[model samples]
Target: MRGGVNMSGWAGFSDEELRRMQRKGAEQRPAESGSCPAPGPRKAASSAPRSRQQLQRERALQQAAQRSRAAGEEALQAGQQLSEPPPERTSPGAPEQTAGPGAPSPRPEVKQSPAAESEESREEAPEVKELDRQEAEEVLRTRLQVLQQQQSLMEEQNRVKKDLLTRTLQLKSQQTQAEAAMLKTVRAELQQLETMATNDISILRGRIEEADWEYSKARKRYERAEAEFVSSKLDLHRKAELKEHLAEHLYAIIQQKELRKARKLEELMLRLALREEEREAGPAVETQLEAENVETVKEADFEKEAGTEEGAGSKKEAESPEL
Candidate 1:
């Protein structure tokens, strides 16, 4: 039973198995290292700080791997001890003797009671139980080591995930900072444009004021010229009215002079008719006619002189300078 237990314990995991597992681990290490590349110089320069929980977890994984390796070593040692031949056993009553290689040693036979046999069997039972327990413990240890290895692998995967998350967050923060800088630049440009626009508006307003002032001045000058023209037109209208009145009064005076000359000639004709009726009155009548004719000619000459004087006065008035 003890040998069976020993064989079973050894069978649970042998040296070959340990070597195979170790070789597998060794082969995977390079691939794992290659898959998870080391940080570059630039990445190292901006390396993020690890959290307390992450550091603690990494430390725990390392401790578990160490423990698993130690357990594997102990199991290997146990298997080696089981594989070695058991030490030679001798009864307390017998003594060790040296024998030549060509001769055989003689042995004594002894009889055993049922009680003695039973006692021996009873003692062997606990030894068998102990071997079985030891085998079970070894099996459990191997299983625990496997579990630990699986746990370590899972921890590595989690670490990689954390690293990726950290890198993504860092990139996002950098992008946000860049955007903020661009926004600041845009705002500055907008402020500069607004300042330039304000300056231009001020300049335009000044020009508009100047134009308005010039327009007001021109309007005033036009108003003054229009007033002077209106006064001149009024003066011309008054002169025209005065000339019409003078022309009408001169025409009336000439008509009255013509009527008076016609009346004087009719009186002279009546005096000639009376002188022909008496011969004694001929010379007196002829002398009176001559006097009348002379008076008529003298009055006509005076009227002509008056008309010439009036014409000269009217001509002088018409040529006079403006007030």
Candidate 2:
């Protein structure tokens, strides 16, 4: 989703259309929470990623906030004073709540466990502090997710900024070309001034002064344009260089991650295949091992028989000689 560009839609979009898309993305962005909440959530949305990661994070944060609020209320009911941070922004135009006698009483903080009287209240916290603790953990985890979203969003903004810089450079180049044309016009005017040099001396003097003034203005304009063009060109070069580096690094990282994934998948498949083979061959392997053991036993028995027969025959031959 980080790279899900609508290339077709992009080609068709005018500057105004592109801007509208960017704004629409920003407006549709869910409210941010405890973290930096810096910027570019809207731009991130323009990617139109189906991940729903941001949406899920926002929802988790809302739930955590709700739990925090409930805990505060319960603590308040238990005669424990609690301070609360400002609530995170939600969608616009939330209905207002007015205070009146008709308003419902705050719900009592119900505790599943019995409360110890004076000692627990002395600390100025209710048993629901555990609930608050759990909610804090949830908030921390949500913060991690928000940080990731911000990272991706930051990357997207960088790309957008790069495009803007490229456009600005192009415009600047065009402006410089226009300035060159102006310089040509000024040269033509100087030729006119030279032609007038032979006319009435007083008239020529006036024209000379006019030409000098025009030349000065043109010179200043040219200098300014040249300086601006050089600076912009340098800045554009730096941005492009940095962009290429980032692209290369990101590409390498993606390749590495993909390779790792492929390896893992391969390993898992191999394990599965091996498991199937083992299951199929298990009995046969066991039978072969058993047969080897049986053969060894038989060979041992035959050696024992041969040794006994030779000993008995040698004793009988000795007895026959004695006879």
Candidate 3:
């Protein structure tokens, strides 16, 4: 089992998948064993075109290497424990093994001393620790690169959002201005119509009064005369003409007023819709990121405080004398 791979979790996997995973795990063994030379610097994911799966595989490789290293350490420890001398099983009164009369004395014991074995283990520890450190650094580097890329993307998105917001605001302002202008125009037309209506009413009132006077005079003249006079007929015709003119003018003014009011309302509604849309679509991506950044800074400050406390505890322990 020492050199064998654990393919225990291959329940739903095909042979091809199993073989590939095994092959990849094996490829990472040399790095894990600390027999291979140090890995050179690697490219960050941001700088080069790397598939997502490839980066995932690299992370998997590092994890597998770490597991292999841990397993190797466990095996080494087991071997050390096994190497320890077993307890003797002699009876309390039993004698030590005596060399036979003709048997030559056993060669002097030349087994490795405990101190030498410990020293060897100590020497091996650093080598394993160094490999673990390297693997950790590599993993952190990849993660840092991913974070940097994510930050850049977020910044770009924020910039785009800002530009869009600016455009919307400009458009809203333009729409507002247009609506105001149209309102002003409509207001002016309404004022003009009102003035015209006033003038027409005054003119119609004067004409009606004049016609009434004329009709009265015509009736008087007609009454005074034995027969209806021609002059009386002319006054009646003039009165009828004024009434027709007043009615036509009033109808035209009413139509114009209705049309202008409808147009103004439509424009007002359009402007309101635009404003509502702009309001609903939030325009504060940068602000939100800023808040997130503030939270991150606060978290970092807390982490630093914890780290300082840990260091202070370690220092206190170092200063204190052992009992």
- Scored by CA lDDT, what does every candidate get? 0.54, 0.51, 0.50
Candidate 2, backbone clash total: 1
Who wins the TM-score comparison? 1
Every candidate's CA RMSD: 23.6, 65.7, 60.3
Put down candidate 3 lDDT per residue, 224-301, tens digits, no spaces.
783444545655565466556655755665575567556655754564466556655243444445545655675567
Comparing 1 with 2 on lDDT, the higher-scoring candidate is: 1
Candidate 3 Cα outliers beyond 4 Å, as residue runs? 1-134, 226-323
Work out the TM-score per prediction.
0.39, 0.25, 0.31
TM-score of 1: 0.39
* Residue-wise C-alpha lDDT for candidate 2, range 1-323, written one tens digit per residue: 21221111111222342344345434433222232322354344444454443543343344333434454344445555444333332221222222222222322333332244333332222222223444445545544554566678889999999999999999999999999999999999998897777566878789999999999999999999998888778666665666576567657766765676577557556655676677776755565566556556755675576567556655654454334
Q: What is the lDDT of residue 114 in candidate 2?
A: 26
lDDT of 1 at 316: 55
Sorted on TM-score, highest at the top, how do the candidates line up?
1, 3, 2
TM-score of candidate 2 on Cα atoms, chains taken together: 0.25
